[model samples]
Target: MENNIHGKVVAITGASSGIGEATAIMLAAKGAKVVLGARRKARLEALVKRIRVDGGEAICLETDIRQHNDLLRLVSLARETYGRLDVMVNNAGIARLSRIDDIRVSEWEEMIDVNLKGTLYGIAAALPVFKEQGSGHIINIISTSGIKIVPLQGVYAGTKNAIRTIAEALRQESAGLYRVTGISPGLVNTEMPDHITNEAARSAVKERAAQIGVTPHAIAGVVAYAISQPDNVDVGDIVIRPSVQD
Candidate 1:
């Protein structure tokens, strides 16, 4: 049994699908009580049922991370149900890839709101509670796009890079008080590309993902590793991608 994750209360955003869903199941199986948040109520309900059937502790709340209050409520639910929040995974994100000249202003704004501000709101909601407990873990899901900086991914990568910067700074400031980890995953089979309004860009990304995307479970395993570490050891940053990805 993994003692570090067992019985820990973990709240995950974007829990309806992809990385979030995989992480929820993985951690819950390891004996963590998982509180799930996402905009899709029906999906959340189904996931909760699945976890229960598997004899794992789980709950769900309808959440839209673009709204700060939703994040607050998510953290509140974890604490209320489990008595303390052990980990907060800022995994909710959107991708609207387009060249800067395409002038897709609305798409840019959407990425900024969901990808950037949403992460900040999660930090706002969890930091105080983590501080109160004198110990906690934050795992922010980032992307390799932020590291490689490809064309048509300018805005999307920018948002991820911003979170990477913030997570690092928080790690530095928190010192021994809490743990901060940034998980930058390469193309995984997820619904993120579907959010792209640009048809051409969407098609290209989807093709690439279909060819080389790793399983969401792979990323979830990485998250478990970060959280399972001893309290004094912080798994600062993890960048994972397919071996074939350039």
Candidate 2:
């Protein structure tokens, strides 16, 4: 019933840039109080300053999602500052692409830690809060890489798809008090590609993204739309890709 976003408190992880930052701004513009978490303190602070200047309510916390404790601290901020949290957006993600032959076990571990375990940490922090609140929403930022099987993106895709399954299982267990949504975006324009170490693969993906990657704001629009729907309506899975993408 509280589908209206006005006055609701939303906590977002990885809010320094890309989809997380875009969602925070969009939600705030629509009247939601936003709490942002990311490792980049300067960027988070700047975004907060901008939000405040726009007459929006926002707070920034320096957080690294790799640590479960950081995620706990993030939700604690929402409750301490806003009295309650209505939504949690798990948007922190890292994609380091390499071929299986490269055997970049460390990079593989990094992806699992940030993309998969990071999301689980968000759930661990937010689920109890959601249950206590009686109504809350969890929006997870996955990727279309999971939906499309491609070389070099294997581990990245695995992490994303793992979260997708998590979202679905979480939804089934909600039992009417909570909402879990997985948003899959294809080739987004962001700094994620910077993490790729393989020169050829990095350049290839960058060129492809540059050619077809959509703005983060477009994905923000989708997030807003999903959260605005009536309580009876739950948008389970959302897939967004450029028109030119096969």
Candidate 3:
């Protein structure tokens, strides 16, 4: 079988750790030239070194997805390094679980900025390149919080669902010029919980995740499956979670 992933240049945001990091390693091992972007330069450097040591082509750039220019640079790095960008994975996000009554305005803004605006910036950066090339794929790492709304995650889920709606709209508007996919993962063992400011909420989430959270590698595999499909086949929305999770 022809390997659709081989030789493809894939740029991934949030590549420093968690889903992005796992996805980077998985895709690189499959022969994709990966361009990694994240704010953690040290971690990105370490990831790049690990990929190289494993004999996979990879590079890292200090990117804060909150910055539109950073996203543009990330895309440019891919094109300049590999001649074309075959895929863009908007995998950077954050979750600050708090009740709606709490009114953590700053935290809400932060989520909007990172989870929602950051994704928009990624699309803005990649769409032009994809349009010019007449072919590209966008894979967004969303969360199942959007699917099953509960207390303390109202804003976070809102941001995710916003992306869900945008992804669908983008897919419809693509006109076969590009592909868009949204992958919503539920309760994976990642550092996302560490970002939660509410102490009690953080502890509860941490406990729950430690018990039922699947590995980020599982999510990475889903990403690989989406990207490995033939260009003509657009794998739309996917939701993966531990069966033990509610």
Give the top-scoring candidate (lDDT): 3
Worst 10 residues of 3 by lDDT: 1-10
User: Across residues 70-106, which tens digit of lDDT does each residue of candidate 2 receive?
Assistant: 9999999999999998889999998888888899999
Query: Which digits, one per residue and each the tens of the lDDT, describe model 3 over residues 1-246?
Result: 336999999999999999999999999999999999999999999999999999999998999999999999999999888899989999999999989999899999999999999999999999999999999999999999999999999999999999999999999999989999999999999998998999999999999999999999999999999998998999999999999889
Question: After superposition, which runs of candidate 2 have C-alpha atoms over 4 Å from their true positions?
Answer: 1-3
What lDDT would each prediction earn against the true structure? 0.94, 0.91, 0.95
lDDT of residue 27 for candidate 2: 90
What TM-score, over all chains together, does every model reach?
0.98, 0.97, 0.99
Pairs of colliding residues, candidate 1 = none
Query: How badly does each model clash, as a count of residue pairs?
Result: 0, 0, 0
User: Where is the poorest 10-residue window by lDDT in model 2?
Assistant: 1-10
Candidates 1 and 2 compared by TM-score, better number:
1
For model 3, which pairs clash?
none
Q: How far in Å is the alpha carbon of 35 misplaced in model 1?
A: 0.5
Error of 3 at 122 (Å): 0.3
